[model samples]
Target: MTMLRRNLMHAKRYPSMTFSVVVMPVILLLIFNFVLGGAMQAGVGGDDSKYINYLTPGMLLLLPAYMTAAIAVLVSTDVTKGIVNRFRTMAISQSAILTGHVMGTLIQAVLALGAMLGVAALCGFRPEATPIEWVAAIGLMLLIVFALGWLSVAFGLAAPNPESASNMPFPIIMMPFLGSGLVPTDTMPVGLRQFAEYQPFTPFTETVRGLLMGSEIGASGIISLAWCAVIALVGYLWAKSLFRKQSR
Candidate 1:
């Protein structure tokens, strides 16, 4: 509970940064939805909306990829400013203090997703099933975010400063082009295509596309769960080790 409160307080203190997260996705959604909306198509279902449909799932998955990894920068910022050392001198729960920032990232992920969904609706994507399916889809997205969040935490702690964390996402931003976000992997070079097709982001994006379009894109939905489990396990373990080392 204290973790949640501290995270929420941080969020309130940094409303502009929080707003940028939401706004960046929206801006990307519109740009993609308008320019490439008609050229993209996936699955057999009738839901063929572009930009929002194509971009939303990608945003849903990759947002955390960038957001979490970038947290290294925030952590770096706090530490470089001596805030973390100051806090360490006080009596703060080791786990709560470390995880509290992650909670803030998670909260940002949820809010940004909500804002993206609103954009999706405005652009003509609709649910064909019950709200439970929407919830389930969101749950899947959240799982990915959580897994990626830990990676961010680890990176933030391990990074020399926040600027390093800030720069970590540049390589990640290009992932969508290689995955299902921009074009079908079938259309790319054989080797790169295979990598993109098999990568974790591919499956996760496929799952989101499946949920939004009311049909399966590929075996991606199944693969997505597997990726989430593996990443969650590995990321959390690494983050835990880092947290322990930092506190020591």
Candidate 2:
């Protein structure tokens, strides 16, 4: 609890980070919902509903987006101030500090995600899920985002600067749009379609959308969980190593 509080303070120290994390998603949502409505219907791209549905699931994955921004700020500022190195000599539990920061980012990510939902509501968008479906959706969001938070921490702590940390999620973030997050895999060429079907975000987006739609789990949820688990495990190890080395 104490560590969580401290991590919250870390975010509070940089309000701009919080604002930024939510802004891009908002813009993307707006662009898709309004500006691109005609193009989406022309089949020049794909179904906007399918795209939004996929994005909705990916938005659950977006907790990582917020975490990446916040972590960049936190790690960069601490390193710049030399507090990280000083703290290495303190009694603080090594993993606790890093994990605590991750937890806080998870919380902020949840809030930002809720804000995204609010935007969805304002835009007259609605998912036809039931109560249990809603509960499952929220739970899924928490788990995926929490896992992705570790990835954010790893990148933020390991990167050369906050700017780099912020850019780290860019590739992953763009994956959703370019792959299955906003369009059907079958909509693309055979090669790209195959790649999209197999990519990490494809499963993640599909599973969450399926769950929200009360459809069968199939393999999407399983695959998404596996990807999250692996990323979290690797990210934890790397972040811990960097924290020990840099903070030392």
Candidate 3:
């Protein structure tokens, strides 16, 4: 709890940084809903407003990706400043440090996602989900964030400096673009469509969209869960290993 409070306080101290996490996704939501919605709508066979329904889930998935840099930068800054070292000298639980970071990232993700959902509601986006489905969707999103948040911490620890750490997670931002986030995978060329269908982000995005829109999740739900589990395990181990090496 102490570590978590400390991390949250650090985030509060830099409002602008966290504010960008909320703003960027909202801006992109507006642009895609207004400017690019028509062209994108063609693939989904719906009007712009209806398209917003499809797009909102994708944007929600993209939110954490965009915020990955901030998490990486924050962790790397702490490492660079020798804060991790100082903490090691204390009697505090070492795992609390990483857990605090993960919790902080999840909170930021929820805020950013909520902001985007609010804008989406204003823009005529509505899902057919029941209360249970809505809860499941939120859980799924947090699971994804939890997995990726750990990876971002690992990236931050791996980078030579904070600036490079911030850029190291760039591929996550592009994961949506390469998946079915923007358009139907069937609309893509065979190769790209194959890639889109098989990628980790697509299954998760599709699962969220399915849950929210009352569509079939089928195998995508299982795949998404599996992906999240694998990522969270790997990232936790990787981040812990890095921290241990730093301590030594």
Candidate 4:
């Protein structure tokens, strides 16, 4: 609780970091929902409002990827500023600082997701899922945020500095473009289609889309869960090991 409060205070002091996370996705949501929405609707065999249903789920999933860079910057800043060293000398739990960072990132990611959802609602997104499905969707998103947030921690800890840490997660921002987020994987070339079909973000987007749109989520849900679990485990272990070395 102490570390979480401290991290939240740091975010309050450095509002740009959190603001940047909200800005990029909100911009993309607007551009995609208004400018490209009609064309995309035509491409997907749906009306403007109907396309919003398909588009918004993918956008919701995409938000976390971009937010990873923000987490990377925060983590790298703490390490570079010798905050980690300062914490090591304290009597708090060794993992508290990292846990605090994970919690902070999750909270901010949820806020960013909420902003996207609000804009999406204004843009004509109305999901058809039942109450249970909505609960499941929210749980899935939280799990994804938790998983990816840890990966960002690892990225931050691995980077030599904040700038590099911020850049390390850049590929995550592009995963949506290359996957099933913006378009169907079947429309791509054979090789790209295969890659898109198998990528982590594709399953996530597809699963979320399925849940919201009343489509089948069986396979995609399983794949998404698997991907999240693997990424979270790997990232948590890597970050823990790096932080331990830094403390020593």
Instruction: Give me the candidate number with maximum TM-score.
Output: 3
**Per-residue lDDT over 161-225 for candidate 3, one digit per residue giving the tens place of the 0 to 100 score:** 99999899998888988887888899999999998998899999899999999877889999999
TM-score of each: 0.86, 0.87, 0.97, 0.96
List clashing residue pairs in candidate 1.
Answer: 33-51, 72-156, 73-162, 73-165
lDDT string for model 2 (97-180, tens) is: 677777887788778878888887676556778888778767766776777777777777877877777777777666677565
* lDDT score, candidate 3, position 196: 90
| Ordered list by lDDT, greatest first | 3, 4, 1, 2
Worst 10 residues of 1 by lDDT: 42-51
Looking at candidate 3, the ten consecutive residues that score lowest on lDDT are: 46-55
lDDT of 4 at 227: 98
Question: TM-score for model 1?
Answer: 0.86
Q: Please, what are the lDDT tens digits per residue for candidate 1 over residues 1-248? A: 67668667867887776676667767777766677566564422234554455566776665776576546666667767887777778787766766777777777788778877787788875556467767878888888877777776777777777777677656655676578766566777899989898778888777777776686656776778888888778767887897677768
Best lDDT among the predictions, by candidate number = 3
Model 3 bad stretches (over 4 Å) = none
Considering only N, C-alpha and C atoms within 3 Å, which residue pairs clash in candidate 2? none
**Best of the two (1, 2) by TM-score:** 2
- RMSD score of candidate 2 (Å): 2.7
Choose 2 or 3, whichever is better by TM-score.
Answer: 3
**Candidate 4 lDDT by residue in tens digits, 25-81:** 778878987899888776577667788887888888777888789888888999999
